[model samples]
Target: MHRSAPRLSRILACAAVPVMLVVAGCSSDSGDKKEPDSSESSASASASKKAEPTVEPAKFAALPDPCKSIAKKTVTSLVPSAKSKSGTAATSSDTSYRAGCSWNGLDDNGVKGSQYRWLDVGFTRFDSDQSLGSGAERARQDFDKQVAKAKVAEGAKKIAEAPVSGIGEQATKITYDLSKTKEDFKYATIVARTENVVVTLTYNGAGYAGAKTPSATDILKGAEKAAKEAVAAVAGTESDKPSGSTAPSEKATDKEDSPKSSDKDSSDGKSTNRKTSANKSSVKKTS
Candidate 1:
């Protein structure tokens, strides 16, 4: 019986070895509670590493001043007796993105009768938006919209549209006749896109007191001249910025767009907006 006690004790000790081993394993597992947290952090880091630029940045940072877009001499030629030679500026919540100017006058000749002229110019600028796309693309979309708007001008007759060159990236001229204020007015609108800016200009004139009506051809020519000057003004704004002031992202975008821009402009080998001459602009008379 005494020998049986020793054997039984040995059996109990053998059983305790497994229980101790189980306790040790549980302790090890509890001490490693941070393992899941480490894995989660690695997952977040991996996601961050995968993030990259999805779209090109905008090219132009700001828009040119609308009032000064044209030269004084050009304004005088377009409007001989402008109510405000400086032009009336359009109201805008944000001038940086949208602006306009207009001028109107009557050149009265006692016997020959009075010549009434009205001119208006407007500008809109776009920015690079991830949801919307690059600035130039946005501008192009707006350009199309403006062209469509001009095609259906109210009370317009003999409407015509034709693509024009030597003005901007791409431009279209729309001409028509409208009777307003008891006078038949000739209207010409030039809708143009320059990089990321959109220029819309309307020129119209009438004959008063049985005066000879202005030629539709003359209206179109005047509209084209003013549109070119406005486009040039937009281009001049870029160089006005301090040297090296351009944002790095904008520079990157410019680099990306250069090849495509060159492809479109290779025919002229120059930027259309940059071809501006010194000229002036005026405002429109709604009446």
Candidate 2:
């Protein structure tokens, strides 16, 4: 009887050993299948990440000096007795991207009422932006905005809008009458675009002390000519220079802000009021 009991106990112990091994093997397999692997986790994270969007490249790389944009003879023809034949430069924090110049003078005739004339030209450049689109596209947007602004000038009368060709990629002429300084002023503004740059040219005149008001035809013609030159100047800039080149050589201009119109002064640096006007459109944008 004692020998049989020992045999039974040995059998039980062998069976228990198999049970323990099977349970341990099942637990190890479950863990291996459930836990994530490092390589697989990295790949999953990468797949879920978002990619950045692409944008088109810009065309024009730089802007021209606004004062030197128009030819000397052209300036003289536009504003005959200009305060500065060299043009009064508009103040710019960044001359590379933005610049402007203006001329205003009263061509005083001994007895005839003085002829008032004012001419101003401004340039703006847009860079390619990932969020804002391409430079040319941005310039086009601003060009539209400028045309719209010119169409709605304050205190303007006899408003006229026309398409002008042969100036730039595209151009528009806006002519109107404005009453300021107790004078009837004829105004012509040309809004033009050449790739990534926008050129805005304004030419206006008034007859003071009974001088004849400048014909809108003549003002529009002069505006178109200056605009053509200003647009061409944009193609001549050097884009690689440092940013924020200021216009220290330029004097005060109306688009810099507003003009304090005065009638007389001969080639002096100070901006005297004018019998003729260069720029005074409060609606004009400098940026």
Candidate 3:
């Protein structure tokens, strides 16, 4: 009976050992917080690291109003007797990014044929895009597209392209002729890119009722003048502003040619007064 009692006591002690261990484990679990899963923790850390900064700031922050881009005098000069004197603004949800204006008119002549004219100016501004490129680069791409579009105008003939200096960062003049309404129409399109802004000005004219069609030279000159005004407007300057329009190349050419012209006049045995007169005539012609 004593040995049996001892064995029973030992068995009870063994059972109590397992129970105490279980209780201790439960207590530790309740008191200590659990660690997060490794995969979830890694994902959270990666998400925090993926944050990136923005690229360079855009050059131009906003665009000017379309209808007011060109001066009223300029509009009147280009499209006399326009149907709408105030100019028509293009439809856009965001005028600060893009805007345009257009005008069309017909000038009546009693005996000769009547003249018809159309003009439109557009301004586009770009903001820097991190995934794409800088604002200026984006504007350059758009400028090329505008030039191409002008060159491929439906039924355009005698297309000519010339690089124009002293206008903007870069500029090009494109001229072509198209027949519409049984009248010969001359077109001049100027595409210019300055900073992050792109300016496109188009001037077209036609003659009706046997009127003489406008010459390409005249049309191109008008377009260039208007384009210069548009560029100036983008710079928030006067239409006839001359600042930043003088090309170094042109200045250098003038400098190099002035002495040569004077020497030639002197070598020809011309008097100083005659040379001065010739210079005046040349200046007048250039102007």
Which candidate leads in lDDT? 1
- The whole-model lDDT of each prediction reads 0.83, 0.81, 0.80
Runs of candidate 1 with Cα error greater than 4 angstroms are 15-53, 240-287
Q: Single out the weakest 10-residue window by summed lDDT for candidate 3.
A: 246-255
* Candidate maximizing TM-score: 1
lDDT of 1 by residue, 1-287 (tens): 98899999999999999999999999999879778889999999989877845567666666666666776667889899999988899999987788899989999988999999999999898888877888899999999999999999889999999999999999999999999989999999999999888999999999999898999999899889888888887776676566323222222122324677668777455454444321212222322
Which should have the higher lDDT, number 1 or number 3? 1
Q: What's the CA error at residue 249 for candidate 3, in Å? A: 30
TM-score of each: 0.75, 0.69, 0.64
List the RMSD of every prediction in angstroms. Answer: 13.7, 13.2, 12.5
Model 2 per-residue lDDT at 102: 91
lDDT of 1: 0.83
lDDT winner between candidates 2 and 3: 2
Sorted by lDDT, highest first, which candidate order results?
1, 2, 3
* Order of quality (TM-score): 1, 2, 3
